[model samples]
Target: MNQLSTRTSPDTPWRLASLALAMLLSSLGTSIANVALPTLAREFAASFQAVQWVVLAYLLAVTTALVVVGRLGDQFGRRRLMLAGIGVFVLGSALAAASGSLAWLMAARVVQGLGAAVMMALSMALVGDAVPKSQSGRAMGLLGTMSAVGTALGPSLGGGLVAAFGWPAIFLATAALGLVAFAFAARHLPADARTAAPASFDLPGAALLASALAAYALAMTLPHGTPGTLRLALLLLSLVLAGAFFAVEVRSPAPLLRFALFREPGIGAGFAMAALVNVVAMTTLVVGPFHLARALGLAPAAVGLVMTAGPAVAALLGVPAGRAVDRFGSRRVLRLGLASMAAGCVGFAALPFSLGVPAYVLPLVLTTAGFAIFQAANNTAVVTAVAPERRGLVSALLTLARNLGLVTGASAMGAVFLAATGAASLAAADAAAIAKGTHVAFAVGGLLVAIAFAMTLAPVRAAAAVQGERA
Candidate 1:
């Protein structure tokens, strides 16, 4: 059997270091603030719902900018966009650190989100663009591990900093990290051909997506009993505009998202896998910690430690997963990973509320390991499936799916917890209710992952047939 090689050449080892650093910095920002949410709300005297916007605004902005920035990278160059992202992210961090009001903080977060969007979209695309396809799987796996490291470290780091200094320290630390990434990227990242294409920026589509995501995010953050009428209306409007945007893209010469990519089995299936993995991984990431800390009555520090299991396990398993994908195929690795994740979710559902820490920790580690394997395989499959010119858009869409999954899962869980508890705040009574609600959420998440597992099975079979015939 022949090795699958990326159309591009291998990057220097230093380039890989730069990629890892950029990913780590971006991911650290993704969840670091989460651990500091309570402090942020208290400091600003913001309500629970109002405080959610701090997170929501970032998601909305990132979703809006993802495809647009990615397209620009394909046209201009990946390294350029990465550097720009670092600069913009650092500026946003400065703004966030200086902000005194909630509104200002949200606005600052949006800037950071846009910067993150640029980095994330281009980073994934450049990995494929710069490396041999044979090595791309391992490269992507390493990158994914860096992401896991950032996420795993964020909570504990944020909590420690908040306990010592304040929320502003989180921004400062991330800014410093971003600066280091920028310098490394500037020195080591390889140059790509900046081809000018007929594909100009899709401003109209960008506007539509931005408006839609903003509305949807706003709906998610609206406090319960705060008149669902307005929220429902905004959500409905978002749906309508999203439909229009799709129609326009279908007819446009250069669509923001190349819909044709969906026709490819590997690309489409990989994206579905990405979404499903996020649904399971994020549900565990967001709810598990919240439950352990708030529901199970564990200390905040202990909760952070428990939460660390998933990413830690993923980081450890990432390289092996990448090697398997590169040698056999991503489809097989993805299927196995999804199955493991589903089993972990089932474990979560069956565990008694009074289950010991070890029981819970085992499942957490398994689920995280599955997520790591899935991410590494899926990223390689998606980027390698497409041409170099189109990688950024595909990578952007993949990143968008991951973020949207987190946004949707977190919002849905928050709503479910609120409905179950029937209380304005999280309390001891609310803990039991939240635990029950989480079981249902885990079941649903498991089902979602199972579907992806099923989807990947057929693709693996098909790809194997093609490989066999060629052999």
Candidate 2:
């Protein structure tokens, strides 16, 4: 077996490095385009709504195709699919950089997003394949750190590139990264050994699942002031499609999603905890800027600087968090991570609003650190719990859950803040109203984390109960 995880092969680190680059580039793709939206709008003379699709198209494409691409990796080969993904990403980036119209840019983004879907889904799966079981936590942590770095780097990097070279420079830079990743992958990534079992695809299930996911994402991300009717319709459409997909999946001989996997507590709980944690985690992004600017009276640049602290903390803690999982075990680390996040949430609610920026920064750092730990542990536990052949699908599910939570959080938590402020709009809210909203939003955030912590305890208790009965 050429499994890099079990050996000290010289290529191991290089192979992992390639995978890391893939992870970084995909995450960079996600956030980089966001900063370019205003530039795109001005350049194309398009409305904010039209330019927004440049970002939305990439995200929707990634969300929709994650599962399908992961399954394809398993059916074909991770290395092969990974190489193709890098190539496609490079191609898309080049196309985007050279785009002449708004429509062309959005289309390019879709192609980029498709490649990103494959890369994001497979990177973690490849971690399981490339790294040893004992060290999977750290590997997952490294990937998580790169993801944070990429995300953190995006806005600042994009802004600089746009200013220096033009909007195209951003895409061109990503294309360059893609090339680096591809060279490493092509040279070092080992091929998968042939499986004796016949390979087949669940085409119908794939199509239905992709459609359902895209619908849900669009519904969740509808532009502000969009009619509630349209959102509701999208939601219903997603549900119906999801239901149909499941119905088809159950009857498929080679199902894209294996229902039986979720029967395992580790797999099922891992997925649920991921979504729950992210929902709470995402609130920081949704509400932090508003609170910082409105409640504390910080300038735009100051708010951006303060907001950068969260991802910075996450990036710094990523490796250590993973090491903790390796040393103390994922379950212990999971509990600790959740507890920290819960406490941070409580701090937001408990601390006096008069404490100003310190109050916010302290709790934000703590919460972000906790999130880094939880993410590493959660991903490691879930990916390791699944069978090797199934890791690709499971990894995709894990990411899919996290993305769904972010989408849900952006819409739901934004409403939670707005409602708590007792104001109709952000501009109308006073400092007192902003303070009240922060307290309510984070209190709810803390409560949600508490729920996740409890969820983790359930399986352990159930196992103990079974053991006691056996005795």
Candidate 3:
């Protein structure tokens, strides 16, 4: 196998920009679709549950395909997979824009998700490949910033597009952006060198992993009032499939995910830390809006403005945080970031007793800044820990961990809110009830983050020791 060189290439800037654009488009697809949900429901005269499949199907497809596609990129070429992904994504967007029915739209969304999986899985790995280790943190940070900015831009852009031209305009716009990304990628990305002896692909293991992830995501996405027995059955089935996947990987010549990677120093910890931070960060995205609109008596526009503050702060600080990671090393920066997040969580929990929007926004900004810092540092650590050949799988695992965290965190917090408010629907609850539920949910999220903070110490020490040995 031809190892990737450590020397900085001349085309590094353009390569990074191309990868960043891909990341932005992937993030934009997600956020933009969210804003169109209600409009889609009304247009199709479909039930909310049916309309929700649009989002759920996309998510499931992406989650299922990430690991498989990442492995493909590793074996073939990241540049090839990425270019194909963009082409497929653009095609999916066009199909979605021209869909005649809800089912067709949902199917097109699945195609979009399949394309997005390739882009997301290869994004970080491509960065690790193109950028030298010494400067990787900055590139990863920039990519993270682009992702945040894309997500932040989505709702506003989607709303505007839908209002002026209709929901189809959203898909058309995404397709246009996809075309631009494709052009940049084709012009800028370096070609992948072929391996001398490519290992056989693990088709069975891939199937097992896909099945496990799909089952779990479905269970998580099921309606709030879904039958407990049915949920339990799905959970059990997922566990069984996961166990089978593990067994297959243990024996397979080329496993879908090499379990040995986790044995690497600090890699496992980095994955855990990534998942925990996302769990806390996603709580704000999923639950905070309801609290703002219903509990705090803010208008929809006011809620959007307030929520934008956190991501905007994160976007502004992302590159600086990356620079900090490079200067101070990832461990210290990661610890500091986690500490800030914990503090922010505490502040969020206290918002019920506070006076106004400033109180809420301040804590959110703090939390998001910490998340930004943590993401850059932790991503740097995880990618750097693995070998060049394994970076694609590591990237896919990191993305999977994040998706799991987001889904699990949202579900857990939703349950907490329901329990605290003693109401079936968030909309049914009055301001006092919403406030009470928000407090409890934030408190729980804070406690989880505190645990992650403590868990991170050992990995930081391990990483420090390795760096010292190298020095």
Candidate 4:
């Protein structure tokens, strides 16, 4: 395999800024669209299940395409892939804004997801490519901060836009941001030098992986009332397809995802930690708004404000956390982060027994801060673990783990909430029932975070041992 050369030096600030802007736009688009779901449902006279495809389609498309697109970036050029992705994403946003029907909107979202996948896969890789290893933790922290800001602003911005203008305005705004990002990226991002190795795209491996991911996403997205047998079948199919994907990858000379990457010390653990943190943190994204609206009687704007607390705190802490990781090492920072997150989850689970709305904010802030610390350190660790040439692939794996966790965690926690409340839908539940359901979901999330906290110990010890021997 041949290595590619980057046009920009590792110390250039322009490269980091451009990459950060692109990441913010991509993440902002997802969160903004989520805020428009109910409005879209009302405007199209569609069922909740149908309107949900707007989000689901995007996620499915992105998740399925991540690995393949990442591999393509490594083979071609990361900058080239990023520019193309931004162009496609802008186009998709324009189409979504002009959509005439629910079906058209969902299809456009799938396009957006594809473009987002390309951007997501390459953003961190590009950062790693441009920044020195010693400074990577801080770079990852800054990038993570941009992501948090996007997420933080999404609900409030989307809600205001929807209330004042319409749902279409949300997409239009995103498109306008994309255009700005495109201009910045084009001017600032350096071109990648091509490798001398033969270019081989793993078509079969891509297909199998896509099938497995799509099957699993579909299974999870099915309506709560759907037949158990059908869901079972889809799950089984997903497992089979996943098995097939591994088989294909092992035989292929140039695989979409290299299995050997996982064998690197702490790489697999980093992926697991990524997934687990998202699983614990994303509960707010999926369940918090409904709890606020139905149980707490907060309007959309108020709910957005309340929900913004977590991301806001995360964004504020991100840069500092990165610097901490750079100074203290990833293992120590990671353990501290995991512990903070678990404690936050415990507090979040007990919100129903607390005084009022303000009580909820503290736990969210703590959890978000923990997320920032963990992500910055873990991302740096993952990027540094792999060879520079394979950064794109490792970045995609990290993203895949997070997306998988988002989908699975949202589905599982939603189910738990529904079952606990015994309500067909959260919107239909009374305050008491919603409170009960929220407690159950948060309790489950807390438990999962605790498990993740425990899991961090082994990897931390292993890393310490390696450093000791080297020393």
Candidate 5:
């Protein structure tokens, strides 16, 4: 059956299976490590701030390298690069599992992140390659489910492994899964056709963009206690580098990012909405565990299970959401997604500790379901609008924007939590403090959704009247 992939059509389940696994691995990498943050802090005799880099290193690495790697896939071959990516991920996972010190672990995570970036960037474009345009929505939906599974499943899975065999078991299991993903990818992914116009790699643009993203992500996600002046400097530097990047892109004949392309309705609006939604959604991933563990006094295992509620909703609804996009339209479904997310934010803002986990779980699930629906519609619209040659880069950009949101959420929301609680550390934060922090964070998240809604409103409304708007 594996050998018959060349003879098999693009619509086969196997093609999507490989892409699904890649999405799963990449998504799980962050949250799984998140679940182990406390353990890592204890094991390495480090502070919460120092140990957080275990998660940030991977995100930073992925965020910085995503576009460059995506372009390389476009110029070279997506299948070949994807194979290399899986191998690198597996190698890094093994190294992480065997790391002797916190520094070594963080370094290994960077390596893992680089590979995960390729997996995420390429797996998305590969879905376009593997499926016909008509089925892209459904295929993307399934990919969304796997990503949801990874995100939702990570805490429970990591918790179980940590309980049974300690922190390293998480990476070991991830590495083993990587091997399986590799095997499927090798057998099922489509080989790239030689391009008539070869990709012109934009070395300067890539460097500037990577630097800007790194600076921005670092400034946003940097743990508190850093000198405020330093964080401000990094933020200012990031803005300068970003301006320089755009300046360079405007000049480069073959730019890394196409500025003119983003002017279109679907592309611009889709990117903004995706980023905002992720920024809002990340609060749950970063803050929910603390609320559950400290505010509600749940154990580690219970925290993991409770955390699964939202992601489980995401996974369950992803396919249906995609089908709805196919049957209705992206704009309509996208609006619904935004509405659900807003309502979820409102729910979280008023969450009461006395009601226990169910109160938290219900809102969380609603938010996650909205995320799944939004991605299915927004991603499908964006991918279909771009040319085949540009799909990989566009796909990478979407993933990059989403990554930016996640890191921003982790850092800013964590900061908000810390400030609201008035605690020096999570260890010191009590039920009342945690409750206050969670409410504050969710309130901020809801406000962001309002902003996102404003940005998206013009485009979706224009899309209704403009004959040129892509679905």
Candidate 6:
């Protein structure tokens, strides 16, 4: 019998680097915006809700487009879509830098979000298209690690840029990075792989999915004091829409998500784990910083610095975590990661308002470490779960799941904190109330991690078995 080896070539390293660069920019837009927000508020003399729209608009665009663009790439060409996305992103950043009005800035942010969505969805998809199946996990892990690095660095970088040169600098920096990444990607990345099956755009499925997500996001954003009956009606209506969307997706000849892919235990479990982990990680990331800074009277830069600790730990541990996944099993790493995350959440929750910065930093480190390991293993599992031919779609679906969790977590946690702190009264900002709210948010976040842990141990066992059989 002939032997076939599965390994990436030396020349392929540049492609991986390009993928990392692309991933970093995609992530940078998300986290960096958080740092620029305070400056944006003061510069525009905007209300809190107006400044928040800067964040919300970017997320809405990215979340809505991530999966849809991925499917389009699969139908057309991955590299082609990536190039277009990058161009659009750079243009948006430039416009963002020049904007005098908050409305214009938000519009530019939406454009940038669309570009980011394409970059994020296609970068990993391209990696899957290029790398051998045996080495896919390592490649995906590296991409995830790069994303973690972007998340870690974004706060500090954004804050520094804002402090030094004002809010426009952040967008300028992003534009420069995007251009550099685009150059590298164009030079180093290979042509997109061909598909044997007939490919066509799934417009109906895409519209349905986008509408469902939009409705759900709107539902979550509605005011707490909204009439109870109206809220109930909206929730029920949203659920019905969700059901209709899922049915349409599953029945469509060219579904955005190949529902059958989840028939494989590994693929399904990996996606679920991805969603839960992101939900947990981001819930803390969003609420913790705001509570510490605006509510607790800490400096914005200090909050950013403190927030950097967790992601920095994750970035440092990423490669090692990937190696561990390859050596041991995803189940073990995932379980341990979730356990550590849960522990950190518990520790964070127990912290009182009087707790000092040093006390918070320690548990934050623990949380970051857990996030690093879980992300690496979870991503590795997703890449390895599918065959090479289907990796693009699978990667897109996984990325979509994670981003969806981010959008959901951000809104949910914000609402919880707002409710707890009585929306932070005009003058006081309510540190004690926010701290109490943060405790509740952290506990909920911990529950998410714990659920992921349990799912990994149980359902994922069968998934591992399936992967082994395929191997």
Supply the global lDDT for candidate 5.
0.86
Q: List candidate 6 stretches off by more than 4 Å.
A: 1-5, 38-45, 132-135, 162-166, 221-237, 290-301, 350-355, 414-436, 460-471
lDDT of each: 0.79, 0.90, 0.86, 0.83, 0.86, 0.77
Error of 4 at 258 (Å): 2.4
Model 6 Cα lDDT, one tens digit per residue, 1-471: 101115666657788888889999988888888877777888899876678888778877887787788778777778988989998999999999999999999999999999998988888777665566556556667877888888767877998898999889999999999999999989887776665764667777788777776666655555445566775676677677778878887777777777777777767777887888787777767777766685567887788667777777877887788778877777677777888888888877887767677657766778878878887778777766666556556777888789767756766776665666665542355667777777777878788877777776656456457665322
Worst 10 residues of 5 by lDDT: 1-10
Give the per-residue Cα lDDT of candidate 4 at 471.
12
> Which regions of candidate 4 are displaced past 4 Å?
1-11, 42-45, 163-165, 290-301, 350-354, 422-433, 464-471
Q: TM-score each candidate.
A: 0.89, 0.97, 0.95, 0.91, 0.90, 0.86
Per-model clash counts, in order, read: 2, 0, 0, 0, 0, 0
Model 2 TM-score relative to the real fold: 0.97
Q: Least accurate stretch of 10 residues (summed lDDT) in model 3?
A: 1-10
Predicted structure with the largest lDDT when compared to the true one: 2
Question: Considering every candidate listed, which one attains the maximal TM-score?
Answer: 2
Model 2 segments beyond 4 Å from truth? 1-5, 462-471
Model 1 scores a C-alpha lDDT of 0.79
The superposed Cα distance between candidate 1 and the true structure at residue 300, in angstroms, equals 3.3
Model 3, 1-471: lDDT tens digits are: 223346677888888899999999988887889888999999999988889898888888888898898888888888899999999999999999999999999999999999988888899998876777778889889988998999899989999999999999999999999999999999988788667777899999999999999888888879767898887888899999999999998998777787877877778877787778888888898778888888888998899888999889889988899999989888788888888888888888886544778778878988999999999998888887777777888898888888888877777777887788878788688888887887888888888888877877776566578776421
The collision pairs in model 6 are none
Error of 5 at 330 (Å): 1.5
